[model samples]
Target: MIDIRLGGARPESAQGCVAVPVPAADGGAPVAITPGLLPDDVAAEAAAYLAETEHKGAAGSVQSLPRPLRQPSKLLLVGVGAGDEAGWRTAGAALARAAVREAELTVLAPAELTDAALRGLAEGLWLASYRFAMIEPKADAAPKLAQVTVAVAATPEREAALAAARTVSDLTRFARDLTNTPSQLKTPAWFVEQVLARTGARVTATVRDQDQLAAEGFGGILAVGGGSAQPPRLLQLSWAPEGATRHVVLVGKGITFDTGGIDIKPTEAMQLMRKDMGAAATVCATILAAAELDLPVRVTVLAPLAENMVSGSSWRSGDVVTHYGGLTSEVHSTDAEGRVVLADAMAYAVARLEPDLLLDLATLTGASRVALGKKTAAVFSDNEELVAGIGTAAAQAGELVWRLPLADEYVKDVAAEIADLNNAAGNPGAITAALYLREFAGPLRDRWLHVDMSAPSWSGGTDGELVKGATGWGVRTLVRWLQGLAA
Candidate 1:
């Protein structure tokens, strides 16, 4: 974790090292040195260093020459393009990478920068510093860099800024843990137990057996999980602060594994089925982080956990099921299990919590992934202002999200012949999934946003940029947005 602060001093000044704060692009003060002053050394010996700092085709080199009148053994400058905030963040990240490799005792981020820019630098550096080298065979150890010092020159506020950066780093790592855990280890039952273990929050868990599900009319859960030996469960976790300004409901799809049921996916596609619970992992982490942070806004987290498998018992296509909210759904594809379970979960949230805002996250569709790719998640909602606010928060959090259209007329595509709706609407699967959930969202629809995170929910071979297998994608963005709401 990185310790951030605001002050007027050089990072190396305290311990005999030096850092230069460069001016912003808009120009106020040449706050510090802008990486352009160092001589470029591009050679084979520096190949490893170049690999660590290069970005988007930019040449990364090391400057070995001791600048005239400099006391340090070597003077290094990381090139951040003139006044570009994005460039600054990249430069900060690159500097951290090089510093860690060379095992420097302390590195600095010059203060006299805006909160947003400082935070961006902190985030990039911290994220880049994360190492998931656990999976590989052990190598000869190198001396570790024990500390990072960000020089806060002329800025009086130091404590709060440092605390905020630490908070962001902690929450993100927590989310990564949930996503990284295997499905067998993170089952519905296990999820409840973990939440209870955390303490300091209200938790209610209900596991509906065959008879109980039938009696309560939660056809969505039963139909989706009937094939699996593990039955389905619905868990609700809440945290309320005294005199909370508003209540928010968060619904997460918790499919332990998705075999695509009868539709069945290729073996390669099924390899990472354990990651199907990515959305649930995000929600669980969010609620826990909120409780830990003691945020003043009341929050309720709802998770509908199940596994979609293959068996004679699995609900087949054309099956009609009645959900917990009394709405009927026709299953057109067993692979579309995400929307089915989420429909009931959303309904349960609105009916019980009646929150001022409603939000749900899931690895719901491949279409969404194709549309937005791994760098950004796609957001669909009926509420424009809420969408804008979320976008702002996403930018600040350093996570990317693009608002998509609800397309009111597309609502008709989900209409069912025998039920209130069809879980699989055949066209624009992701949008249809959001629409199905909206039907049961009730009054919360006006204050809702549906996030389809179908890509990068789980990393491939190795973890990169602060994520192992599970990226913990939404925690920071949601937390930042909630903070704004509280303000």
Candidate 2:
């Protein structure tokens, strides 16, 4: 984690690389670039460099000065396109990348730094500075920037914003670390242990092994995890503060590694299956962040941990199993196993927890990625208010989520002749998978929201704050949404 601190004004005098924001090409108001923000000689030199290089201020664009007339070792002209929150975040990330070799860095906050903007800048810096060196060989070279200072006005609101930013950044990185770990090292038991270790007094975590799962009738989880030598487990993390007004139950599909069981995936497709538990990592991170922030809401997380692998005892296609609420489902494809485990967890949440609002996330389908691309998660819900609220939260957090119609008419696609539903449907697979989970939502279907996060959970390449691996996509959105409920 990067040590980020609030610094005094005049970032040019700060150590290491000093990042200064430049407005976009079509920027409306003229942001005063005076000596007060940057030294007069340095500002003139930057303007000359920009003119020489034809540097139009577009978001995520950078221009570095190796020999600058300033106290700082180097100067960075970071582009703030349109001066929006997203643009500010992009600028912050760009600055981080440019200053990757620097041991210390400072970002000069713009004159119009609102609480939201400050949070965005801080998030970008911390997120971009993330490095996952768990298994990789250590480099003899000096590490990346160990400390970052954001030069902003010292106010109570700004301090609160910075605190929130730190919470999200740290938890998101935590999720990324869990998701990127090798599947062999991160099994069902390991996930439970990690959760228990991170949770505080406000949160109580309980784990139920295979024996308990069978007794509780979680057939879906049991069947999918039957092939793995390590037994399946159901982890329930609850945070119910006294006098809490609303109950929000979250279910995450925790497939530590997916090999498609009896119906195996191709060799090329099986490479990144370790990240199949991205949803579990995300929800756990959100709950931990909520506990840290002390949000006044009753939150419960149901994570069904399993590994979908192939063996003599592997669950085969056409096998029928009864889920938690007695809903029987036929296994059409083992690759569609995420929704299977989630079904049991969701049904259990509805039957036992009786939440005011229920949301489940899973890397459930490849068709979702094919349909929504890799940057946006597909959302499905019958409740308009819930959809709108999540949309607002996503916008505030700069996460992309697109709401697809529930299309109840297509429920028959997953309907089976011998069972209540089949795990896999033909075309429009994402919607059908969501519909399959909807059946387990019971009478409170309108209160349930299912997010198909297969697409956004991992990034193929570096983009702004998102790195090239597990993106930790949903944590910030969930945190912001839960915070809104508390508000």
Candidate 3:
């Protein structure tokens, strides 16, 4: 994990590389220096370098000056285009990549660093510093920057803002780590253990194994996991503080590994199936962060973990399984098993938890990726107010979420001849999948929101705050939403 701290010290006095922001001017090169906290000589040299090189200070651009730059080991001139929050985030990420080899770094906060800008900067640095070295071995080279100090004027509000930023960065990295781990090592049982270990004394966690799930009539989970040697698990994590006013239940689709069951996917499609559990990771990280922050709200998370493999016992197409709420689903395509497990969890959350608001996240359909591209997650809900709230929260957190309508006409696509729903809906698959999960939401259908995160769960390459893989897309949005409820 990357160590981040908030300090009142000026950037020029700090050791290691110091990132200085250069705000873009009207048309010519950048002329404004943020913070203006650098030493006189260092500041003059940076201005001269920019003028001599004609560095425009475009967003995401970096200009580096090696040693002999006054006091610091190096000077990094980062571009903050238009001096907006988004530009600051891009500048922070660019600084992180430029200072990859440095062991310690400091970023001078803009003189007017709003709470939003502070959050963006913190998120960028911590997110860009993430690297998964679990399975692959790394070279025995010099260590990357382990500590990052955001130099700002110390005050209660700034300190609180810094704390919030650190919390988001840490938990987002936690979710990323879970999503990046190899499926072989991160089984259903392993996921449960991780939840317990990371959330000790913060949240109450309980796990229901195969026998328990079967006894409880969780047909969706059982049928999906029956194909694999490792049985399924329904893990519940709860955080209920005294005087909590509202209850929110989050359901995550936790397919540890998907081989597409009897209907195996092509080799190219199955290669990244280890990240099928990205939704589970997001929910777990969100609830744990809420508990750590001691938010005054009751929160519960239901994660259905399974491994969809090809075997004699694998549930095949045309089979009908009765979900927890007595809604039967016809398995039209074995590859569409995420909605099946999620159905069971959603049903359980609605029937038992009776939450005021219910939200389920899943990487359930590739159609979502096709429709919304790779950066945005598709959100479906019948309630306009809930959707608006989600949109607001997502915007505030800098997470991209587009509200896809839940048209009643789309429900016909998932209608089964012999069952209440079908796993595979023909066209507009993402919308139909949400309709399928809506069946389990039952009486509280209007209170439910489904997030189809097929695309944003994993990144093809580095982008802004996203690292190479496991983007951890939904954690910040969920956290912000929950925080608003508490507020």
Scored against the true structure, residue 11 in model 1 reaches a CA lDDT of 31
Q: What does candidate 1 score on TM? A: 0.82
For model 1, how does the per-residue alpha-carbon lDDT over 1-487 read when each residue is reduced to its tens digit?
5443444334333333333333333333222343422222312223334344432222122232233444443344444544344555655566555565344423344334566555555665666565533365345444244455555553434455455656666666766665666777766677667656664535333445557766767778878989988888877777887889899888888898899999998999898887888888778777777776678889888888888999989888899978887889888888999888888888877777779999999988888888777667889897888899889888767578997778777899999998889888866767777888888888888888999987857655332244446777888788888888888
C-alpha lDDT of all candidate models, in order: 0.69, 0.86, 0.86
Clashing pairs in 2: none
lDDT of 2 by residue, 95-186 (tens): 77888788888887766678887788888888887777566645655457787777876788888988999999999999999999898899
Better of 1 and 3 by TM-score: 3
**Evaluation by lDDT, superior candidate among 1 and 3:** 3
Give the per-residue Cα lDDT of candidate 1 at 83: 30
After superposing candidate 2, which stretches have Cα over 4 Å from the reference? 9-15, 27-35, 68-70, 136-142
Tens-place lDDT digits, model 3, residues 264-327: 9999999999999999999999999898888998999999999999899999999999888788
Off by over 4 Å in 3: 11-16, 27-30, 67-69, 135-142
Going through the candidates in the order shown, the clash numbers are 10, 0, 0
Q: Return the TM-score for each candidate structure.
A: 0.82, 0.96, 0.95
